[model samples]
Target chain A: MAEIARLAGVDTSTVSRALAGSPRVTKETRALIDKIVHETGYVVNETARHLRGGRANQILVIVSDIAAPFYSDVVQGIVETLAERGINVLLGVTLRQAKREAQLAKQLLTGVVDGIITVTGSIPKPVLSMPGFERKVLAISRAVPHEGVTCVTIDNCAATRQVMQHLHQRGHRRIVYIGGPNYSETYRDRRGAYADFMRENGLAELARMRATDSFNDDADSGFHIMKSILNEGDRPTAVFCATDELAIGAMAAARQADQIIPRDISFFGFDDLKLTPLMSPPLSTVSVPRFEMGRRGAEALFRQVYKDAPSSSKVVLDHRLILRDSVATIV
Target chain B: MAEIARLAGVDTSTVSRALAGSPRVTKETRALIDKIVHETGYVVNETARHLRGGRANQILVIVSDIAAPFYSDVVQGIVETLAERGINVLLGVTLRQAKREAQLAKQLLTGVVDGIITVTGSIPKPVLSMPGFERKVLAISRAVPHEGVTCVTIDNCAATRQVMQHLHQRGHRRIVYIGGPNYSETYRDRRGAYADFMRENGLAELARMRATDSFNDDADSGFHIMKSILNEGDRPTAVFCATDELAIGAMAAARQADQIIPRDISFFGFDDLKLTPLMSPPLSTVSVPRFEMGRRGAEALFRQVYKDAPSSSKVVLDHRLILRDSVATIV
Candidate 1:
């Protein structure tokens, strides 16, 4: 940057601004700076410019699956922000498989990517337990439980608490919680929140209604679980699902059983998937800023790589309550 | 090959068999070959050993949306097959954006991946018109009217003919066809088949309902077009959606309008999405063997990359009609 600035008869800041194609820079100056860059093969220190690693120009954004509905917008956000700094993204999909996650971790050891931001928690615990793993790995919307590794996740516990509050306020004494497996940070937080909140609210009787791994991230799981719940004599006035996929599944089951959403039984869900709006009665969900989460995860990884900054700062993007028709105001 | 055979005290064929992990090769021989490979870093020319790509150990799988539901299984198939050969995959998601596609095309010029297989026709016509692009690209579930490009697609025309035959034989005179953009080969063939098959069957009156984008691909476009058809008088007794997402949107609209699926009217959909079987009444649709399409697409690309074989021959994978409750017997 300093060399380019000297050649262009401009300050280093102006050179930086020009190279970034900043709107503040004059078009002619930007073009001139670009020409000089091409002529000299000037490779910018993208990491330093972005304040991540001192100059490592690379970040690995790991998602469990590229095709899964939960992570596309987040990946899109990460790619968009990184593209400006000439930092390339290498995507790794773990497929929720432990072996694949281990292989990806081994591949990362090759020094191909400067830092890794993983959304999947499928990696073996022993790998993270190994020394020399600090400052290089970050979790996104998932937890690794390591001291040096940071995370950018929604307030899942509070979100679950809010759902219980919503149901309780709506005059629902019995509320069922349908959740995924215990291995995931997402599922753990949600289940813990449900148990704690229900007990705190004096709705201890509702705790027994909770179902685990009832929705293996699928609608059919929700359907079967809902059927089993409805088949029992006592029924909850409202149900809260861990993710929107489970919510949709439960919704399908309710409809199949000739029950109407919010009329007979209110329902709540999380991770407001795009299709949630299109469901028969738009789902009431905790709208996770997945795009922002992805963008921040990418930015954080880049920041650690470019600036050698602190690696322990956890950033929580906002999640909003979308009060769609599915949540009945019974009170 | 000779080196491996000499080192292992085995014939060249035995060495090859052990490396290929053929059942005929004893476990001891396979273990011996593996140890030698570990010692020598002996890279397998997967293409040649498989009698496909003699030396190409890289495969490129391009998707319209790396996150879309449509391409997930296809990618899984490609990854599983290629991983078995110790082949590396370079995944490029175009996001259905033309500018990005052009940029990715330039990167493709670097000869990084051994073979290129795209889910749809992503590269612009002008981009493909450029020299040196003729021999490498293959279209999966799509057709490109270009020489040298291999196409691995489902028999869309025949499949559509079967759909129309099923609907017509069910005593339904009026039929509707909802499709996608004009550039998509899958949509084009389905629409063309709808028209030709309708004309041949003397159902010209119902052939008036055809929808397509001017120059872009979007499922919402299909939903709006289907809405217009529904609003008009004398609605079709049966409807055929080119893809499942479009069908889903159409179904939502029908549900909103109090029209019961297959009870008030019949609907046939394509691409049997994972969510389809879980949909209310389970969508009556044709299931395209996407995994096979992807596996074969990579297989064809490797064949070209290693042997310099001209694979202009289009391969058609299987498509089966799943008789779910969505399409009622109209008698």
Candidate 2:
């Protein structure tokens, strides 16, 4: 550190502040220090620095699947928001495995990361029980149901109710709900809301299908479920899917089965993915504030980690019902 | 460690091996040690362990964007492959910013990670010039052009030639090529191949369009570029895009202009994304083995970091041309 300071003609404290990305260090000084540090091949031992009680200034962002399009926008939001604050994000994809999630939780408790922002909707049980876990953990997209972990999520039930109301108003009585696994609180709420809306509207006899395999909820799963339903000749006027990927797959299956979209069956989906707008008839789905959820989640986590704020707050962002060409009125 | 071993009725080395996820540790003993560790709230300080000359067992995977969808499958492959070896993945998204890329490269040098696998194609100059960097760095998807960095990539030129030959065989004389930024060697190779093939086939007069804004190469960019071309009254018989996202967007623009796919204009794309098969016309694209690229990249990186092998080798994966409904047998 002193060598870098001498090379950059700055004090050792100034060199430290620059390396820490502190705002107190002017841009010119930071640049000089960075140049000197790079030129001198001075590798900062982050592990040693953290061992000496300095902040890691790094957070672990955990998600269920990295390939799932749903988490991408949210993660982009988190990475961008945290980057502006000079924090590095270390992403961990659990692939929906419980053991992997536990391993990651242990890593968090081991102090490699200063905090964790989990978009997987659930925190490991051991992590929740750890002392000070609340202060260093935040959840997004689904509520963790724990009292201490701050969550940034949308009202999935309300979003589902809006979809149901739209379909109901369009004179659709025979609507089939295809959902993902019920392990996710978000999926569970959506399914529950659909059931409630149907029962209250005197349309409770409609059949429902859910992804039996907990590990599969993507487009392929949606396609197979829709194909089987079509094969059984149980064609409803409309199909409501838990996700846009599922909806896309369902549409493909319907096409393969010689069913025309909107004319033969209307499709509604959740989590209005980017591909939704470019679909054949375009998908009528819920527009989730995924990026906002991530941004807000990171901000909330930062508050807890840096400001010593309470970690029990819940922030629900707004969602919109995007009615596109996929839904058609039926008399 | 001693306390845990005492509680689990095992030696300290057994506990250590179990914690390190060594193959020598029996599953039953590992489970017992894990249970005791969790029950006793024993936090394994990874930072301290690394400082004591132990392996970090973590690698950093860097990409340009997380939401682009192009990197998702590749990242999944890397994560799964590394996880099997008990190595954790720390993903860093640079968002295509050079400054951010430099920052991430600096992080790798700081000893927070054992090695780095960059999917972003180019490594920062400082990182490359650092002593012994060759033993700890790997590139994927695009060749780094640096001597010592092992690259796992596909023959973009060959893939483009296959697409071109397929189009030529289908009697499509007028084809347009739309590509991403030239900063990427992958895109550059694809573009170069298109030019060479067009000239070789005596079709040099065909027009070409590329995304001028280096940062924007997604669906929206494709849509705008295609829309502009349509507005200018340049209706090529076929359009080939560098990526599936771009092709999807181009198809949407054609649809908006009331152009029926394949019947009015044919469309072809590269990178057979999971969403490709679900598109309205089921886009015909080059199926680059993205997952295998990732898997191979991770394996090569492991060899360099663990086995102390040379890092100058290049692994070129195969690409397949998928025939789907989007392209027509035009006369």
Candidate 3:
């Protein structure tokens, strides 16, 4: 650091900041410092510099599956935010594979990133036990047992409870809950909330007909899940899905079976995506704070990456229930 | 390189392969080579290495928008293919913003990536004229007038004509065509096909009902566009949309207006997305070989990047039309 500073005729701090691509330094001076480093074959050891400066320019993001549409927006938000700060982001998708998750954790032993943000629940304790993870990891949309790992997510249980409450208020006693695979954090949150809300409201009889988690948010999957329920010949008056895609699928199946939405049966969905409103009977859904989640998640990572400041233990955002034409009063 | 080989008591080529993280190299040798490089402050100049090997390990991919769902599969294919060859991918999304597109072109000027693949239309000729024109470059889903630029796309014009023939065979005369914005190569192909098909078939009167370019594949956008046509007291017995999202929206609008599918009006869509089958009345549309297109596009870029082959001028893939419940014979 002192050698570069002496060669560039600047203070060691200015040299450090310039090399770090800090905007506070004049562009011309930064260029001069960069040129000197290039000419002299001088390369700053990023790991060592990070240790000395107590800050890092890297953020790690772990997602359950990169292919899933639900995570795309959230990942975009984090990437855009961190990119602005000149911080590099390392993304890992577990694909909901436990072995892959373990491998991803082992890979993180490279210690390339300063902090970690995970959207998956199954974070292995062995990875966090690494010496570098004292204060640099946060989880989003999932919970971690480690007190060191803070989380940013919506109140999934509360939101699903509200969905049940809304359905009840609309005079729907017989309501079906369409859930995804058991491994997902969202499935657990929503299912737990549904059971609690139903029991508390004395609607346990209505909760007896639960659709198994097989289908994703796609219509084909939703159709089959809805079909099995309808095939039982004990039709629910309304259906609540863990995700909007599932709701759409179920709606298609109902229509195919000649059951009308909001007329013969009502539907409620989660994560009100752009396509939700375009459905024939505009779907009613809980709008996950997608844009905000993106903004906050990224902002949180950047704060740690740049300022070396510890983040809030947990950051919870608000989710809104959007009432559309999919639900109706069962007079 | 010779120093590492001497230290490890191995051949220079063995040392080089180990340092490059080649799986062919023994794990012990690879680790030893990495340690030697770290200890000696050795930096591998990628450009110089590529110059000797006649191949580069980096690829640049430019797309119109990353937020859309269509490109995810394409990216996934490219990533998978590149990961196998130990090549790194630099993804750039233009977001339909011209400045960002130009900026991305500038980034390519530094020769950071060995080859380029673009889904965006005509890169300003000046941008392509940049210094590193000798490496590989392919355009996906677009045609550009560059000597070395290869184009990989579906035969859009033929595909459109096929759809029209299907509707015609179903005995539909009053058919309206929905197209995309004028800026894209895709719109040009489909629109040109529509014009020629109508003229040849003596359906010139019906061709005038082409929907405005602003109607992107959104449900509301399609709904409003369809509503305007219906409000004008001019209704097409059949509608052919350029994209499936638009067709879904148009169908939603027709339903909102109390029009029955096939019974009152029939619809056809392009791009047989997964949702098409799940639609209330499954959409009848043409299916683009999406996974194949993605695979071919990546393979083309990789071949050019590694072989320095004169970009094969163009590659066109096959497409098929799917018949579903959305269209019916004019009864």
The candidate that wins on DockQ is 2
| Model 2 agreement with the true structure over B231-305: per-residue lDDT tens digits | 878688999999999999999999989999989999999999998998878999999898899899999899899
For model 2, state the Cα shift of residue B210 in Å.
Answer: 4.1
Clashes of 3: 3
Give the per-residue lDDT of model 1 (tens digit) for A52-94.
3223344666676665678766776776667655565655666
Compose the digit string of candidate 3's lDDT tens values, residues A275-327. Answer: 78878689999999765776687787666655676767778899989999999
Docking category for candidate 2?
medium
Better of 2 and 3 by DockQ: 2
Query: Scored by CA lDDT, what does every candidate get?
Result: 0.73, 0.86, 0.73
Worst 10 residues of 3 chain A by lDDT: A104-113
| Regions more than 4 Å wrong, model 3 | A1-67, A86-94, A98-117, A122-129, A134-138, A209-217, B1-58, B110-113, B122-127, B209-217, B307-310
TM-score of chain A of each: 0.79, 0.89, 0.82
Q: How well docked is model 3, in DockQ terms?
A: 0.19
Residues A1-331 of candidate 2: C-alpha lDDT, one tens digit per residue? 7888888888988988888889998888888889888778887677778778757777888998878888888988998889778777777888888898887776677777789999887888768777788889899997786777888988999999999999999999889998888988888998999999999998888746566367688998899999988987767999999999999999999998888899999999999998898888899999998888889999889989988888866888999999999998998
Better of 2 and 3 by lDDT: 2
**What would the TM-scores of all predictions be?**
0.79, 0.89, 0.82
State the lDDT of candidate 1 residue by residue for B1-331, as single tens digits.
Answer: 6888889999989987787678999889889988986786555432233223223244556676655677867876776666555565655666677766655554344333445677867555434644556557788888777776788888999998898888888877788888887667778789999999889888876686566666433446655777777898787788898887777777777777778888887889999877777666578899998878878887777667665777776888889888787887777
Kindly report the root-mean-square deviation of model 3 from the true structure over all alpha carbons.
Answer: 6.2
